[model samples]
Target: MATLARLQARSASVARQYYYRNSVVDVFRKKENDAAVKIQSWFRGCRVRAYIRYLHRAATVIQKRWRGYLGRQHYQLIVKLAYYTMKMNLYNAMAVRIQRRWRGYKIRKYCFNYYYLKAYLKAVSETNEAVREALEEFADMKEREERKADLEKEEKKRDYQARKTHYLLSTKQIPGVYNSPFRKEPDPRELRLQKAKPLTHPRPKVTPKRSASLRNWLECTRARSFPRSAVLPPIDRKPCQGPFRDIAEVLAQRYKPLEPTLRVAEPIDGPKEARAELQRQEWTRNVQDKLFLPFSSYHKSKKHIPAMHLSSKYGPDSYGSQHFREKNPERWICDKDFQTVLPSFDLFSEYGKLYSKAGQIV
Candidate 1:
């Protein structure tokens, strides 16, 4: 029974505590606190909320102070403007009043002076006419004298211009001498320097000599430092240009035709051999075709002549293994007159070809 009683007491105490915690006033207070906490949480934390509130207060204070300052400045500006406007109005009024008084004075003075001048002019009319006539006569005389002086000066200027410098130099002096306005007379006792000599000889009467001009007398001058190379050698570029056309034809008869090589040629003695030789000759007829041989004068695929032929080659010979050069310098300049001239090479090759062990055609 005592344990049951104790349990009942604990239950009643729990019920009372629950009722107290869940009361209407407490619920309202808790709701208000939750709302405040929610706002604080939205600001990141309690510290952040306090900082934001403080900054808001500070900014409001600063804005209020700034508005007040602006109001004070505006008031001051308005007061200054009003004062300046008043001052300007007062100055304008004073100037207007002074101008009125000055106008009245000027009108009075003008009226009085007009009368005085009219009476004075009426009194001196005859005297003024006489003075004017005298002045006109004096002006006319002065004008006539001035015109005569100007004419005399013009005549003197023209005479000076017409005078020759040669005559001045020969006479050694100027007549009716006037003091020079710019040129001061030389002091009689001052030390004097001699006149300077002429800058160069008088302008040449004859033209100067030029080397390249056909009409000029000048020619290629001999350079003593390089005497050997300075010799005037006849530069005959083309042998067939001037006088060697007929001579070449006549000299060509003197030289013997060069021997042929056995790079592509074949001989036959029998009927079957002749038929094979004819077929071989027909196949080699195409000059564009490149065949491997002992030597070729040109490249296989290009129109350009290859340097291999220009070099000294011991190419094959028909009669014997005779060595020969593709380009002989003695025959290059004038070979038509030579006795041992080589046969002319064809556009592609008559006998010249590339040497290959396989003897394949490309």
Candidate 2:
């Protein structure tokens, strides 16, 4: 019985240990499964975070690209609008100018016709008045001549009667001498009488009808408008007198030309050299007279004219005169001569295009 009881206790102990080991393994398995689930959850969270970050980055890039595209499109639209506006303005200005020119033409025609008729009538009236005055002076001279002739006749009649009475009374007393009193021998002091004729002054000649008429017309007419102050004086400008005459005489003497001499320089070796030398000499000579002479030769052999070399010295400014520049500053004179000598340049090309556009607008 003791042996049987000991074997039973040993079997019970083995079974209890096996049960305890099985329970411990189940608990460990449950713990491992919980840890795996936590790890999977962490991986899913990380994947979601990575996806969100990628989406944010992609959205930012798309927004920037869209903004840039819109900006560029807006700029292009603005430029197109400005260009159309400028073109419209230019067309309107040209239309206005054409209308103004037409109106000016009509007004000028009316003014010229009205003044011409008025001037002609005034000239005719002045001529008539001058003729009337000349006729009156001639009539007065004829009347004076008739009165003087009547007075001379009366004096001669009185002298003849007195001489006849004295001759009749003294004839018998002086028979041998035969001194007749009618012949004025009775009184020596009153023997002969002399009469003087009246003197008449000459009348001035009347002026020609055409000359007087034109003069009156010009004086009555209004002066025409001109753009510049350097205008010619009236056609009736008279010779200066007194102090003004002296001043004019002095100026004439001062401005008189002095003796001039022309001397040729040595002949150049080539046609180009000769032309260059001639231009330089001509420029020097003209400087003394305060004149500027631009040299341009069409000769095939002559290539060194100052015009050909203009780009080297004065750049594009040498294209035209200062007056042309003042009127159209944006326009440049572009020629073969200018382009050939001009240095290769990007800045000038851009500027030249802008200038050409502005020139076309003007």
Candidate 3:
């Protein structure tokens, strides 16, 4: 019982301690929250006051700009109105001046025309008097000619009547014979049978021979010649001789073969192993080591093979190695005994001739 009580007392003490701690924490937190709220409120108030001041300044600026704009607009309006009014007055004055000048010109023109008409009418009247006298003479001549023509016509009619009477008396027609007005005698059979020449001959199929006149004209033309003032370029017609001995000698001296820097042994002889080793070294240095330079060994970029490059199963490096024949027995066999030989292309063949000499395949 005593142990249980002690345990209970311990629990009670722990509970009291937790309560005190929570109360203290709550009190501190409340104080902190209150202080924070006060500080935030103070900052908010400062911001609000600043914003209000800014708004006042902005409003003042806007009002000032608006007022200035209005004043400028009014001034421009007044200036334009004055300028337009003055311009209108100037135009009115110019219009009046132009009108006066035009009216004066019209009056002067009218007076000139009136005086010119009076002079023209006077001249026309004088001309008309002469014309009237000439017309009377012409009328008298016409009347006399008409009378002469009437007299001739009467005499002709009388003579014609006399002739008709004589012809009627002289002509004796057989009774009951009807003479047709448009009758003509039949042509002789010989004349009708005669063949007439064709008016137009058929054009020759062959081209007509050049006329004598055209030939003569061609012969008359002189040969064409260049103008005397024309200048012609000089041309060297003589065949070129061989180079001069002096030039040949100079060329020989200048372009002679360079002397050997190091003497190369004739009939070169070396051990097969050493030669092969040197060849291998050269192949590795030239083909393998430097072939793909400026690129990492693991670069994914492919090597660009030329269109004409031959593809082989064996790698290029192996071709240089001494063991190439062993590595690629088929290549060696083909190179030596089983070489492939392509037949020569016959250009005369149909397909071959499809490609013209100009390399165009049409």
Candidate 4:
């Protein structure tokens, strides 16, 4: 019963103190009332002195009430604050336990893994050591064989030198190889000796036959020794001269017919089949209408064989195709009879005036 009454009284006291402090702070803050009070105090000095004394007493009470309020609030919050602190401490302790257990588990796993790796490494090291020992033994055996070969070679070289000296001194002619282990010229020595011809003249028995055209081509391509000022043979010239004509006429003349201008007649969104058919027709027209070349369209009735590398740039890494073809003639078949088979200038001219139009011969 006494504790309950004390609790009620304590709460009421805290409320009264909080309200009283608020009212005092409010009164102190009012500028108008404060100025009026100060004016009135100047007029009534004794009453103003008594009011000042009362105000002093109220300020002391307010201060004491504020201190008591703070103490009571602190006392009330202690249980809750302690509860939160205990909760936080418990959480921290549990987290630490979990972290320690996890760390222990990880450490144990890591140790097991490390042991497994160490065992595997030891096994590998043992295998490597065995292989290394075997390799060492093999290397020693090889060294011994190599040493034996070296000794034998030295002895053979000494014996050969002695034989060579004796043969040179006695017969005054270097003897042929006698039971030599080392390599000599004309590799299979016996057959080379059996079929040996005199070394004085090294003359071949049969002369190689060659095609005249191939020979001429080879001679033309190959470098020949001559006086520096000597004239080289020129490429074959045109057999006949071109008919005399104005340069403007020759340049302006077109060998191929001018293509007719195409026009879109209407905004026609045709079906797939119709568009495909139109594309096919266009392709056929393009194929039928020959593309003109300066040489082939004007001179040859037949179309010129377009060079595959006409537009492509050949870098220095690749050899010129013309030179490659001329050098490797076995890649082609040649006629021995026709040494000068190329046409002359008469082929291009049809008896005088140059025709601007092409013939549909091809």
Give lDDT for model 2.
0.58
CA-lDDT, candidates in order? 0.58, 0.58, 0.59, 0.60
Q: Which parts of model 3 have CA positions greater than 4 angstroms off?
A: 1-23, 26-31, 34-46, 53-69, 72-87, 94-113, 117-362
Ordered list by TM-score, greatest first: 2, 3, 1, 4
> CA lDDT of 174 in candidate 2?
57
- Each prediction's RMSD to truth: 33.3, 45.5, 32.6, 30.5
- Model 3 per-residue lDDT tens digits across residues 1-362: 99999988799889999999998899799789999999999999999999999999999999999999999999999999999999999999999999999999988876568767899999999999999999999999999999999999986765555443332221135311122334464233212222222234469699765332323322326542212233332343332344322323333443446443112332223334577888898777674454432355655466745344454533555545644233445656454333233443344333322434553443
Model 2 RMSD in Å is 45.5
Give the alpha carbon lDDT tens digit for every residue of 46-79 in model 2.
9999999999999999999999999999999999
Clashes of each: 4, 0, 0, 0
Give every collision pair in model 1.
293-354, 293-355, 295-353, 296-353
Top candidate when judged by lDDT against the true structure: 4
Candidate whose TM-score is highest: 2
Q: By summed lDDT, which 10 consecutive residues of candidate 2 come out lowest?
A: 335-344
- Report the CA-based lDDT of candidate 1 relative to the real structure: 0.58
The regions of model 1 sitting more than 4 angstroms off are 1-53, 87-91, 98-114, 117-142, 150-362
**TM-score for each candidate, following the candidate numbering:** 0.22, 0.25, 0.24, 0.20
